[model samples]
Target: MTLTINTDVIRRLRDALLAEAATGAGAQDAHPHRDAALARVAPFAETMYLVMIADGRSAPQEIAAVRGAVRLLTRDLLEDADLDRLLDACAAAASERGAEVMLQVLGGRLCANRGDRETAFTLAAAVALADDEVTDSERALVGDVAEWYGVSSKRARELLGAMQSTG
Candidate 1:
């Protein structure tokens, strides 16, 4: 048996592997923290939107609040079309998985970071009060989110109050 070694083939393979590595590294470097921040906030947005739906209806204001919060949190990292797509996906997930699953995901994500949990609670409160009044069911949902976020009831009240007053 005779062995044939082609330098051109070896060089081409090495170049391809290097190119792949560079491409991956470039993507990772492009927006290192943005993706992570978006992932952390997304569950909370979906959970907040679901809270409104818990009463069997999602008001336009509630949906708008979700869109605004997701937009504010994501900022330049997402385009309008991209935000709408992501929000739609989140809403679908909530609809398919049910409230318990949504709560678990929301709680897990919020618990990962204290600051995020606080901000999430504030955002949820805003959504709850978007229509100018929080229904009994919405109140209960907000309470559940606060408890899951480890926010004291009093503090939750204070945060919700501040958000309401500012609005």
Candidate 2:
């Protein structure tokens, strides 16, 4: 599906990412202020992705665009050293635990909104499948997300199967 992102949503998410990156870099007040600032961004990022996935229009190119825009905004908001730190953090996070952690964060938001857990899991699986191949790492991460949502493996398998069959 062709994903046409909402410019307003993209702009809001971009701004939040930049602000969070800056807060992480000591650009903001010390103490709990930084955490508070970042907390504000978390919901927007999570909700935006949820909306994108639900729309069934999340293409690899669109995902790449969103990631690139976030990175650019982050770099612009933070100093060189801070930007490096943020990038390093992302790399390390992705490497250490794959994308599951990120997915969980987003999942938490969806759960709060009483969203469909099955659909959310399916959407995450679809995101992993966006490249036309579900890598082992991606599959593992999707499984983790499914588990987080209290979805049985059998049910997850069923949902995934249904999505695949329809796609």
Candidate 3:
């Protein structure tokens, strides 16, 4: 006898896991203002995290760069533990479903302001180039992120180039 796992079942499990991470017992706001800041930055963080892991591997350099970018963007409004938890949640969600689904979920609600979009692009590019190399999938995912958030391809490429130049 042979047994095959169902994709739908896996998808459902992933959805449930993501939902729980969003509102489960441990997910609590320490302060209203801080929570508000986190809320604003969460989508950006998630988007970058997805891009970092798009190549089916997460390097320490990428993780560190993403965390540093997120911390700078959030301006210490979110605690380190909370930020890690949020990134871990994003990783779990993206790993379970796939990059497109993760991007779609984030695309609907991320980076409304011009600054936010620029920041998102910067964070994605930083993570992509953290290890001094950008894989094809990482490049495509960064473009996908730019497209989803209504950023022009020209601007995205420029941002990536800027990051490369600085480093």
Best of the candidates, TM-score: 3
Q: Please give the lDDT score at residue 71 for candidate 2.
A: 38
lDDT of 2 by residue, 26-81 (tens): 33423334444334333323322432343334555324332433334333342344
Please give the ranking of all candidate structures by TM-score, highest first, separated by commas: 3, 1, 2
lDDT of 1 by residue, 1-167 (tens): 01111123323332333333233212223355656756756776677677768677887766666666665565445445555666787779877998777777778877878777877766666666666666767767766787777877566655544322111
Q: Candidate 1 at 49: error in angstroms?
A: 1.5
Q: Give the TM-score of candidate 3.
A: 0.71
- Please give the lDDT score for candidate 2: 0.44
Residue 68 alpha-carbon offset, candidate 3, angstroms = 0.6
Q: Give candidate 2's total backbone clashes.
A: 0
- Cα lDDT, model 1, residue 158: 56
lDDT of 1 at 166: 17
Off by over 4 Å in 2: 1-114, 162-167
lDDT tens readout by residue for model 3, 66-143: 666555655545666787788878877876978788777777676467777766766676667666667778777877
Kindly report which residue stretches of model 3 are placed more than 4 angstroms away from their true locations once superposed.
1-32, 162-167
Could you tell me the lDDT of residue 107 within candidate 1? 84
Instruction: Report lDDT (CA) for all predictions.
Output: 0.61, 0.44, 0.64
After superposition, the stretches of candidate 1 with alpha carbons farther than 4 Å from their true spots are 1-37, 162-167
- Which 10 consecutive residues of model 1 have the lowest summed lDDT? 1-10
All candidates in order of lDDT, best leading: 3, 1, 2
